[model samples]
Target chain A: MIEVFFQYDFLRYSLFTGVLIGILAPLTGVFIVVRRLSLLADALSHITLTGIAFSLLLGRYINFFAVLNPVYMGMIFAATGSLLIERLRHTYRFYRELAIPIILSSGIGIGVVFISLADGFTTDLFSYLFGSIAAISSTDFTVVLVLTTVVVAIFGLFYKELFFLSFDEEQAVISGIPRRSLHFLFILITAVVIGISMQIVGILLVSALMTLPVAAAMRLAASFKQMFFYSVVIGEVSVLAGIFAAFHLDVAPGGMIVVVNVLILLIVLAATSEKILNRKGG
Target chain B: MKNSAAPYVLEVKNVSFSYGKQMVLEDINMQVREGSFLGLVGPNGSGKSTFMKLLLGLLKADKGNIELFGSPVQSFRDWSRIGFVSQKANSFNSGFPATVFEVVAMGLYGKIGLFRFLKKEHKKKIKEAIAQVGMEQYMHKNIGRLSGGQQQRVFIARALVSEPELLILDEPTVGVDADSVRNFYDMLKELNDKKNITLILVTHDIGAMSEYVTDVACLNKCLHFHGDKNDFEVNREEMMTAMYGHKVNVIEHNHSHDHHDHSHDHDDLDGVRS
Candidate 1:
């Protein structure tokens, strides 16, 4: 595996991008899960898919559009979708979750139209949906690195405020944290993460990367800080193992990574359930 | 200045609030003197919660001036001087992953400022706040693992960790048991009397709070009464009528035995809102 990675630049790019996505996803996922916006990730990723499809459609006509990376367009659409979600949530305050399904459906509806307009699934669309280990280039790796750095920097700068907001939003507001802008910034960050992660995890499986590791970590974590640490560890391990397995098996890394995460979640649940059963029996 | 009389810690004047079309609070006016334990009692939907939110600047009043420490609430930027224990303090997500110490330390976040790390002094303050709430033994435990009452106490510790001059609690003992409620009031009393922290405790049970508070205010869409407990006791009949918007007969029981009776009265009065 080490020899293969050194021999092929694409393999190196895939491994590097996978590791970055692993840390970035769960790091942002902790806040997403705690804030109960886990489904918003799903919504945003689907919107990102629409953006990718639109970019692909444009690529077929205009040479200038073809030169532009689809990831940039995906990010723009994801951010716009995130802002729209926030706006709709505020508009229908009584039914906040209504925003999720509306955006998700719109994304899928628009995505299908674009796909059909482009005359069926191209290799690009398939790779965006399931992620292709072979398609990862050095440019994709750099893009992933930049996105990861931005996410980490934002988390570092706003750690306390973010923690307070996620734990209790009302309290955070009462404490005089600027609620609207911070919330919008959070949504924007979530959008960028889903957008950049499409090359490795793909749009469909992106939310799985964001949530599954945190789900497993929640069972054992004693504190928010510990939850974050455990989630990152779980995420990194799953990504590394999945990428290695995919390399050997010649499969898509996105599906394999999510499978590893599911396995980890099952193992944690099984272990915790036995302890709970024993305690009850005793 | 000195001759003009001391400034109040909080003053709400001509406050009127509405949710969409239905009015929640109308012409509400109240004041809290410095270092006084003011108990705000009212039935559910009587706008006690809404009033608290307005005072905390969480909600803007449609018409009114809320002055905190002599500054208009709109200009009151010194939030660290005020601590708020929200109505859902005990009802927060049970799966929220945080230790007692971490929750308590959150209170100091506002005071610690942005882009700054918590120092040893902040840690010491958190420990002291937890100790003050008598939750030192459980400081390391996950907050969710504790009982509802314990969680409430941790939230109180979180509020106190900021060492605010004014502490406001909005129906803080809602889900707590009778004994825990009694102890909770006792802790608030201690914070008021010993630490000289001004307290505004909003609860449904006027009787439970009547024994500990220095002042009492009854509310039902308006401030029916706001005065010293002695005056409140003198005009209890008139106050009760005004508070409920209907005549309510009362028998004055001895002060020492009011706790048990108050808890019983609250249960029967569960749905009694004007």
Candidate 2:
């Protein structure tokens, strides 16, 4: 397996990209889960799919777009969709969660229109939807690396502020944590993470990578810091194992990674339940 | 020990606020002096929350001027100087994955500013704040595992961690048990008397409020009364009846009285009917 990775540039690129996504996804996902915005990741990923479909459609007609990477287009749409969701949330302050479904539906609606306009699904579209080891180009690896660096740096700088904000937003605002700008930056980062993660985990399963490990970690970890650390560890293990299994079994790395995440979650739940039962018995 | 430059920790002059077509607070002029504990009492929808929001700059006053530490509320950038513990603090999500130390450490985030990490001194301050609230035993404990009263104490510790000159608490004792409520007020009184930290507490517990607070203010969409605790006590029944828009009973209890007997009475203003 080690020699196989060394021999094939494509496999090495997928491995590198997978490792970066593994770290970035769950790192952002911890905040998302705590804030009760797990579904927001799903909404943003669907919007990214719209961007990918639009780019693919444009590529069919325009020579310039033919060589353009769809990930950039996807990022732009996801970021815009995030801002739109924020705007809608403010517009309907009482029913803030409604913004997710509205944006999510619009994303899928527009995405389908673009997909149909591009003359149905192709092998390229399938890879983008479900992710493929062969689909991760050298350029894709470089983009993921840069995104991972930026996301990690942002988290490092604003870790405390973000934690306070996530724990109790009203208090964070009173303490003058620049609530508006910080929240805007947070949602924008979430959108971008979802946008980039699609290349490794695919659009449908992108949110799984972001949320599943965090869910599992939440059960086992006592503190937010512990939850954060555990989430990243679980994410890395799942991604690395998924990539290796995908190489041997010839399946979508996204499916394998998500399955591993679910498996871990089930194991944690079973172990914690037994502990609860033992405590009750005692 | 008072800062002569800013004698008043908080000043609200003719501050009026309203939502769409409905007034929440009107012409509310109040001043909180340095080292004084002021209890703000009002009914459920009497604009206590709105007034706190205005003071904290969460909501802009529709009509008047508000100041914090002698600076205009709008332009006030030194937020760490004023600590706030909201009503929502008592009702936080129990599933939130943070230890008491981590939650209290958040108080220093604003003071420490961006792109910086918590140092040894900050950690020392966090532990001291936790100790101040007598939550030292639960420093590493998950906050959700604690009882309601314990959680409330941890929140106070979170607010105190910044060592603010003025601490504002909005209904900090809600959901706290009767005995713990008394102890909670004692801790707050200690913070005010020992540390000389100016305090503003919003509560329905008029009985407890009168016992601990140096000053009192009554509000019901308007500033009904703001004076010394003695004056509030003298006019307690009349003022509360007028403010609540119904007959209100004032069952005064001494500091050494058994709290369990009258705990339900002091929990809510409406609980003591007739």
Tens-place lDDT digits, model 1, residues A170-282: 77777777666678889999999887777787788999999999999999899999999999999999988888887789878899999999999999999899755764675
Clashing pairs in 2: none
Alpha carbon deviation, residue A184, candidate 2 (Å): 1.8
lDDT of 2 by residue, B1-274 (tens): 2234538888899988877788878898988899988888876677777777778776678898998888998898898888889777866788788999999999999899988999999999999999999999999998988898999989888888998999999888777778998898898999998999999998766887677888889988899999788887788788888887778654553333322222112111111010
Task: Give the DockQ (2 decimals) of all models.
Answer: 0.41, 0.43
C-alpha TM-score for every candidate:
0.92, 0.92
TM match of model 1 to true structure: 0.92
lDDT of 2: 0.85
Cα deviation of A144 in candidate 2 (Å)?
1.5
Reference-based lDDT, residue A214, model 2: 94
lDDT of 2 by residue, A133-238 (tens): 7767798788788888999999999999999888987777677677678878999999889877788789999999989999889888889999989999999999
